[model samples]
Target: MKISIFGLGYVGCVSLACLAENGHNVTGVDVVPHKIDLINKGKATIIEKDIDEILLANWEKGNISATSNYKEAVLNTEISIICVGTPSDVNGHLNLNAIYQTAEQIGAALKEKDGFHIAIIRSTVLPGTNEKIGNIIAEHSGKKRNEGFAVVSNPEFLREGSAVKDYYNPPVTVIGTDSDFASQKISEMYEGINAPIKKTNIEIAELIKYVNNSFHALKVSFANEVGNICKKMNIDSHELMDLFCMDTQLNLSPYYLKPGFAFGGSCLPKDLKAFKTMAHDFYLESPVLNSILDSNESQKNQALNLILNKKSKKVGILGLSFKKGTDDLRYSPVVELAESLLGKGFSVSIYDRNVNISKISGTNKAYIDKHIPHLSELISDDLKKVIEDSETIIISHNVPEFKDVNLRFSNKHFIDLVKVKDIVPSANYEGICW
Candidate 1:
């Protein structure tokens, strides 16, 4: 594969050398004369481990070169990678000036180039950026997208100290493109790397880097807060965190990491409140912990607003419990949503296969009686009847029956709090946060 990478900066320099080391003929392009001069002289543009040696060795083998002529580089190579910096501005927004400039230059070069060309965006950018780049290229080159050329979003996952190693050994290689030809070519370019190739849409690939970095920042701040509380209690925070990390079932797993409706189970609500109160009693400021409940409340209201905004007077809830296949109505978010709908003068009907009003006893009865006095009147065991009587339906559980409810009834509006796998987004169906 012959490749041209724009912006001979940190990521560009390492990628050029490493790809060349992987047997791909690479050309480094830049506007800076000194950076181009250094690369042409068989010297790396950045200070990193093993990059200088790799670049020098690849240069000696004639697999690597540098040039400031973007037109010539694009005409020679089959693929072009945009690795220009997307630094922050005064208002904390990304200034994509360099990225647009590089895109324009590549588009101009592609004007005279023949055959299909693939341009990969290796910089961290927000969603919808790939579409904008594709549009820019189409406008400049006087060709349609995916007709003569394609734009791909393939973000880099390289750390500063281990950039060379990280390039070869990443957790996963993400390729986001609409063109099948581009996806195949990009996959072939990374054929030797020992990592799973995750092929997705362009927007998802573009937004993943921001999501990863934001979660990493949250983890660091959360750990610091826990350490602060542990110090005040004279406990070993490191040991406690090590033990916490060992729990692969829930704590350190993907158990609760999903975008959905508010969490309203018995253990979670009770324990989260307990932790927040404990920190408050100790005079500890745990913003992250304290904000959890507020965020959950906001999610509940968001679901409520989505239903209310539909302007339907009749609403149906598919599941009444906190989870599926369970009769536990204790702290169920769907139950609260039903109660709110009733309060708003909207007729509400509910269907739960597992929830039997006549059989429920103890705290479950007490909770329902206090929150919704006319529970028996609103509850129905027949699934089709509940869906038929309501104008809008809320599917909170990802059950098999709820999956095709949207498909079967195309006229009724469907609000999905849980992203049911089989449910497709259409005019009558909408997910809460997806």
Candidate 2:
């Protein structure tokens, strides 16, 4: 397939050389004369591992070339990959001038094109960027989107040191577009690559890079803070981290990664507080560790806001325990939420199959007695009664009994704290975070 890459920067240069190596006729396009001249002379624009060999080999094979002419490049190529830089502005917002400018140039070039063209955004951009690019291209080209052309968000995952290797060996090949033709073409372009091809919505494709980088940054900061505290205690931070990484079930895996309600079980809250307090006692500032509690509180507030926004007098909580199967109510977010609602003068009813208020004893019993003294009055085992009595029902647990409650009580508004699968669609249905 014939492809043209805009912006002969790191991403573009690597993409041009790698795509050419993948048996695609790739043209490197840029505004800078030096970049174009370097590519034309069989030299890589960016200095990276194996890029020189890849560029020279591809250029010598007549499979790669560089040009500043957007019109010619667009006309000659079936697909145009936008690898323009989206640097930060003064306010730290994305400076998308290069991306928009490239879109305009592609749009103008597409004015005279005859066949279907695929404009792939390989740049790291925010959500809605692909939609904006599509609009710009449509406006400039005088053609309708998904008819004359389609804009696909195919973000790059290449690191500077191992760009060429990363190009050929990405974790997955993401093709974010609405058009089937464009998706198929992009998938075919990565046919030889040994990775799963994920075809998804354009916005997800656009936002995934930011999410990945942000999490990576968070991990680094968290590790550094842990290291700082460990050094103070005369412990091997590297060995500790290595052991931490070995626990794939919880630590290194996607156990608690889902977007949902704030964590409020006894262990997480108590342990986190103890961890932060330990750092505080050491006179070490662990902002990342400290921010965890703040972020968790924010999520709880978010859930509270979502429930209160419904403006319902009677609110039913489907689960009262910290978790689904367990009868534990200590530090349960639902318990906190229920207390808040009752305190705010909103009528609240809770149904927990696991929790029997009379059977409660010890600290768990005392905890509820202090937080919600009228626990027995508000709590019930009858799910049907709770559903019928309430205007808004909050599903806090993923119990099998609550799965079809949405379908049963179609009239009641449901605020899902735990994302319940197979929910029957309704105007009343809403996920807390999703």
lDDT of every predicted structure (CA atoms): 0.92, 0.92
Clash tally for model 2: 0
> TM-scores of all models?
0.94, 0.98
Per-residue alpha-carbon lDDT of candidate 2 for residues 165-227, written as tens digits (9 for 90 to 100): 888889998889999999998999997787899999988999999999999999999999999
Worst 10 residues of 1 by lDDT: 420-429
Cα misplacement distance, residue 80 of candidate 2 (Å): 0.4
After best superposition, candidate 2 residue 190: deviation in angstroms?
0.8
- lDDT per residue (tens digit) for residues 1-434 in model 1: 99999989999999999899889999999989999999988999999999999999999999989899999999999999999999999999999999998889888988997788999999999998999999889888887889989999999999988999999999899999999999999999998887899999998999999998998888998998889888888999999999999999998889989899899978899998997788888999999888989999999999999999999899999999999989999999998998899999999999999999999999999999988888999999999999999999999998888888888888899999999877778888999998
Candidate 2 global lDDT? 0.92
- Give the Cα error of residue 233 in candidate 1, in Å: 1.4
